[model samples]
Target: MGLLMFYEYLDKVEQLLEQKKDIELYNYLENMHAADIAEVLENLEVEDQTQVFGLLSDEKATDVLEQINSEDFSSLIKALTYEKKVTLLDLMSQDDIVDKLIELPESRQKEIIAFLDYEDAEDVKQLLVYEEDTAGGIMTTDFVSIKKDYSIYYAIETLRAIAPDAETIYYVYVTDDLDRLVGVISLRQLIISPPNRAVDTVMNENLITVNVNDDQEEVAKIVTKYGLLAVPVVDDSNVMLGIITVDDILDVIEEEATEDIFRFAGTNEDEIYENDDTLFERVRNSVTSRLPWLIITIFGGLLSATVLTSFQSTISANATLALFMPLLAGMGGNVGTQSSTITVRNIATHAIEGVGIFKTLIHEISVGIFVGIVCSLLVAVAAYFMHAEYHIAIIVGIAMWANMTTASAIGTIVPLVFKKIGVDPAVASAPFITTTIDLTGLTIYFSLATFMMANLPK
Candidate 1:
């Protein structure tokens, strides 16, 4: 539902709760989506939140819990008794349960684990050992697989029995008796083949799989590249551990994109969009998130000021030189930002072509040359009309051309170097790139001005 409509419904729900209209409140929420219900619950007082939740059937309540944000999920769980918490946890999938457990304190994690059946607790424990950003961490052990020796008819029978709780039965995995993943057979392929044939004869032995430790971003890429419904996660020995669905991959894509966008804006911060957090908490987080970037920018501003101060004589001789400084620096920053943004995406998607770095550098610099020509012509014409100083106009044009080309080159090289050194290309950052190019921009403008001063139109 639209935000306005949800709020409108929430107002009525609140009025009903105020009047102790329990049945009416439940009936009002009955038809809403679980996500919409969760949103309304977030806006309610703790007592009302639990009261509303308690009205949901176990299945519906489990769906609501899945739909809520982790912070709200944790807060709601804290209000529950141990028995109630376990009842909800039991209804959750393996991945959802692991995710919820991660939000709790270690002691609380242990407390909740004590309530689980032995097999469920053991699976959650196993999943906890994987890094959160890796395939293993996000995978669920809810997939269905059968031994390669099973006949097609037998495989169909086995899948029928397991499909109820399995994550997906669209593409069933084929493992050996030892549980080593050997092949894959789609439901369509299995149904079309002779039911009396052995599954191995119909399965595709050539498979693509990810190791448990592979990054989640890599997992997303593989899934996208292959147009897969899901990808199997296996151990070093090729033993099937779990599977990552496309839905989970989509979450990974959203997370990585948001993180990169924040980095580009120079914040190195996260959690900027948790609207359900308290006003004070949000404000505090925003301040902390932006503080480090502000500090770095200050140092960068000082460095820029120091460079300008060193060119005191040039500025004194021609005060017009100071006016052109901002134009030169601004153009350089704009070009560098464009180049770096494209380069970072190329690095992330592994789409860097077979073209050599020198070829790539030349192409970017050529782009800079065209941009520089257009911008410098405008600046030269503006200088000539406003100040009527041929020497100043000429210097401005040359300075712009030089600074822009240098900015483009630096932008392309910096991220590539970061990638080579095991740093994320995203971390090269717009602030860092702009700061570096500002230093270059200033030095170029002043040096060209000094050269023209020494030799032109004395």
Candidate 2:
């Protein structure tokens, strides 16, 4: 249904609930998909959310609860009765259960663990050992695996028994007795092969797998680069632990993108807009992350001011020179930011690998020259119209070219330098680039003005 229609249905349900009409409300909620019901619940107040959830059938409630955001999920779990909480945990996928449990306080986690099935509790405990941003943490243990010695017929039979709980059956893994990853076979291959064919013989032995401790970003990169449907997660011993499916990688991509965007804007990536997060809390989170960069930029601005002070005589002699100061600095900042953003994004996506630093620098310089020439010509014409002095126009044009060239060079180099030094390029590049351009642009503008004005005709 359309979003408006869905909201309308929720309106009717809320009206029923307010009137103590439980049966009709329950029927309306029960008939909707869990995702749709979760959407409806998301729009309601917390107390009403709990009331609506309380009226859902146990199975429906569990499904809908799992679809909500982590903060919402946490709130819902808190409002649920002990019996309902246990039921919801049981119904969730192991990965989802572990994620929710990790969000709870240690005391609450212990209490919840006490009520969980022994196997489920053990699985969550094992997952808790991995850091949240690693491959192991996101993988689902519910997958079908077969012994290489098993016949295709036996593997199919095994899958039938496990299919209900397995996250995906499109691709099946084959492992040795020691649970060492050996090969992988698609369900299509299994079905097309003779029933008696050994899974080992039919399986493709060239399997691509990720180490359990590998960063989630690395895992996502591999999955995206190779177009994998699912990749196996292995321990130090190469024993398969679980598989991270394409769906999980999609979430990783979104999360990584969100983080990068926030970091680019100099904000803490974890900041969220929950009702419990007060205005001051939100401002503190944003400000603390951004303040360092602003401070750095201030220092950069001070340097630029010092440069202009040293050239005050030139500015006093030709007052028109000051008119182009902002234009030069602004253009330099833009060019630098553009180059930095492109290089950083390329590095993040692994599009260019093992390229020589000098070669990249040379290419960027060439690009800067072309861009500088075009921008210089445009600004020179504009300056001619703005200033009556031909020498002043020429000075501004030359300064624009030099400043832009310097900005582009610094932009390309700073991120590379940071990457080599094991710093996150996105977080460091912006403030550094802007600061360098401010200093360099001012220096170039004043120096060019002093030289051209001294030699050129009025």
lDDT of every predicted structure (CA atoms): 0.86, 0.85
List where candidate 1 sits over 4 angstroms from the true fold: 19-21, 78-87, 271-284, 356-360
Q: Candidate 2: misplaced stretches above 4 Å?
A: 1-13, 19-33, 57-59, 78-84, 356-366
Worst 10 residues of 2 by lDDT: 351-360
Q: Per-residue lDDT for 225-303 in model 2, tens only?
A: 8999999999999999999999889989999988888877677675756666889988887788878878988898888
* Most lDDT-accurate candidate: 1
Query: Which pairs clash in the backbone of model 1?
Result: none
Q: What's each prediction's TM-score?
A: 0.92, 0.92
**Candidate 1 vs. truth: CA RMSD?**
2.4
Every model: Cα RMSD to truth: 2.4, 2.5
